[model samples]
Target chain A: MSAALHRIDTLAPRAEASGTHIAIAGLTKTYKTRGGSVPSLKPIDLNISKGEFVAIVGPSGCGKSTLLKLVAGLLPATTGTITIGGVKVTQPPDGVGMVFQSPVLLPWRTVRDNVLLQVEMRGRPVAAYREAAARLLHTAGLDGFEERFPWELSGGMQQRAAICRALVHDPEVLLMDEPFGALDAMTREKMNAELQRIWYETRKTVLLITHSIPEAVFLADRVVVMSSRPGSIEAVYDIDLPRPRDLSVMGEGRFVRYTQEIRKHFFAQGDLDH
Target chain B: MTDTLLVQSTRANVLSKLMSMDAIRPLILVAVILVGWDLAVRLLRIPPYLIPAPTLVIEQVIAQWPMLLRETMPTLTATLGGFALSALVGIPLAMLIASSKTVESYLYPLLVFSQSVPKIAVAPLFVVWFGFGVLPKIISAFLLGVFPVVVSTVLAFKSVDKEMIDLARSMRAGGLRTFIRIRLPHALPGIFSGLKVAITLAVVGAVVGEFVGSNSGIGYVLQVANGNFDLPLMFAALFVLSMMGVILFMALDAIEHFLIPWHASRRPDPNSGT
Candidate 1:
């Protein structure tokens, strides 16, 4: 426990030295409905540095996803600015990829075509990205099944293709919204390790919103715990786990300490399962 | 070695099941119905003018094949022409309705209102305006067939997973790109469903037009046969019409299967052990 505390203490200085890649200042979101305006997120400040893996974990309806969407520029911030790589994001920022909870693949497209969807969407010549797509699919362990359709693949494989699609364009940042939430526990654990390896290799700055405490600890360098409804940052715990994390790391002392520390925040609020 | 054997046996099991009696059940039921009808008509000694036996209908079809074939051309032409027109017009209209709230609010109700008015009732009006020609038949078919395409397409576009749209936006996909790559492909199964219904309706619409005013088509032939007391010929024409509907429907089904084999509906049943 003391060692875990010491690791958390060291994260701050290292993060400052690396320099910020994504800066969120006074960001908030209020959804205007017919009845009245409902505040989803309170004004919040957070900085994620280049190649940093940050996971935002909170109770359901805490607006953790709202924060991610604001950064992705899918939704406008009610008040404040989000600058990524020194530019303000008014519309969706370029060079950003996202994976949703469901695979959401095009049923008519094969696995290879689905991965190249990013290139096609950008109006870039898909022919040029063929090699890159193949490599990414290979990395995802989906090389032999490029011609297969989404329904032919299992849920885990489909999600892997979604990840490959996101990365095919070599995005600067990858935002995920509870990507493995639908998977069984064993598959989710496997995906966490696969994601960590991918992150290590690609080194894209990532912000993942998740409900699972262990998942956040397993994959993220820092876990940002948020308060329930009208969410605001409660605490940010630096995982401080070693690089290239595997499932075995979950059994380590620091890993359990990190997960427990984050879980305690939700346990206090009486809504932790979600 | 055991794993490969297990997989091979599973494949064989699925193949055998597919080729089993279940595959031919529909054919057997059809044969039974026809045989029953023939036997009942012969035993009761029903007058051919009132209700021709299946054998007499087949004899009439064989004897008048040339005339029947000639009349079938116009009906086929009108059905195909109007269905094509509906697809061309309805798809864009649906896209317009789905993309803009103003268009949807104004036009959607108007479309629903138009759909409520019995299309058969409107067939006479089309003949009065366009005259007793193929144009009126085509117009009537277009009117009847277009509603399903528009409604189903609108629903399809609306029902696209919101998360998938967010993924596209986060990747900096423009509105056009999003529609082409994400919205269009994602809405295919729904669109094809609409197309199937519309194609069948197109056949009905053509027949309705002929019933109101036409000298060609199977409907006109049926009217002529009835006036001359040639009940078997009338039944043969009716048979041709039903066959046309089935052929067009099966064609659409084949296209849907080929295009979206990845869809849940097209996937092999899991319990079949494939």
Candidate 2:
């Protein structure tokens, strides 16, 4: 069992050598309220290449989620451009899937129906995706439970279903915003391992927003650290971790070093105590 | 053991459990109320014409069963018809109001003003305009039933989790698709609550219209019985109307159970074992 759990392979960084797949140039966001204009995200430029896993870590109230939303085109950038796969995003773009902090499943829908929601929302015939939905559910370890409601499942299971719903449409990029924030500590660690396996299999470009430094270092090939309020990228660290990462990897020296390095930024800003 | 025998034993166990004190408490209370009412009438020596005993009312109901059933049909039809009409009209209006602030601003005040006007007072005006027919009763019932549906539906649509909406938008789902797949299903429990309230109000609205001006219906019979000082017959009509309300409410409750058993409200309590 230990040998099987420790089976590992290197994740060759394909995106680093290739040209960018998602390019952001001087992106900014500001809210215009009655009082005045409040800047949310400062002008920033970043690029993510195809089949890469990138995680953005920041303090609470930072614009990490705002950046993800801008890239997904759920919210418009205040100034510059977000181009995905050579197409500039003016509105919600195609070939992108999103998983939120909450599972957000419709209570009326069964697990299979929730997964098929992607096809239904795209105006496609749901019957065509029945097999695909079943496959995704099986991959998520939710097989034989497709007819169950969201409320019938545990929190981790619900989040797994949410991930299946996002990926059922075969999108090129997956954007996740604190997807495991609601889980217990033990479940969160288990989910991180599960997510690593899914990422290795699917190889979809991913941009995840999270607050946990260790989580960012564990899942992401590149960790983009952001500062709070009027958020901007402070630094980017490239992770040299192996693929098929297990919970045991979190105990290694390099892993601690990476997490400590990210923690220093928050500690310096006096935000860590909170 | 045979599977059928095992199933039979389990079913019998469930039936016995249902007859336990917790399950039959409401029935016990109802019995006490009935006994008290009968004793009060006997002790006060109230004239039968003023306030007949429960036994007298029951006897009157059996003797006048044919007339009562005939009159009941019109009231039941009007009540159900008005409630259905409200659901059809009000839900769409709610969607419109939820979709745009301009529409909500224009319609909300008008809705509040209409609700503020006592429906009983409006019943006479409906009779004046539509004449002494079922149309006036239906209109009156509609007026009373629509408000709850509209208000609750709007609240339900607005209460949808923002993250759910964001997830849908990120997938490039169009507005209509989002509404059908996400918003409408999410709003169902709230809509059913409104429908439950509206259905009971519809019963009252139909009866009010009949009282104002009508040639048929139990409400009209009630007015005639009151004039002739036939207390038992009036009580019989009142009993039928209450039963209709209870029946409609239970029907909606059953539908809610079937449709959204995943909802927190429908989930069996862990401690209760039901």
For residues A69-178, write the lDDT of model 1, one tens digit per residue. Answer: 88888898899899999999999888888888899888788999999988888778999999999999999999799999887899999999999998998899998989
lDDT tens digits by residue: candidate 2, B227-250:
999999999999988888998899
Give the clashing pairs for model 2.
Answer: none
User: How well is each residue in A46-98 modelled by candidate 2, as lDDT tens digits?
Assistant: 88889889999999888888899899888888899999999999988889888
Tell me how far the alpha carbon of residue A165 in candidate 1 is from the true structure, in angstroms, after superposition.
Answer: 1.9
Scored against the true structure, residue A218 in model 1 reaches a CA lDDT of 90
The regions of model 1 sitting more than 4 angstroms off are A1-3, A6-14, B1-26
- Residue B237 in model 1: shift from native, Å? 1.3
In candidate 1, which residue pairs clash? none
Error of 2 at B212 (Å): 1.8
Name the candidate that leads on DockQ: 2
The whole-model C-alpha lDDT of candidate 2 against the native structure comes to 0.88
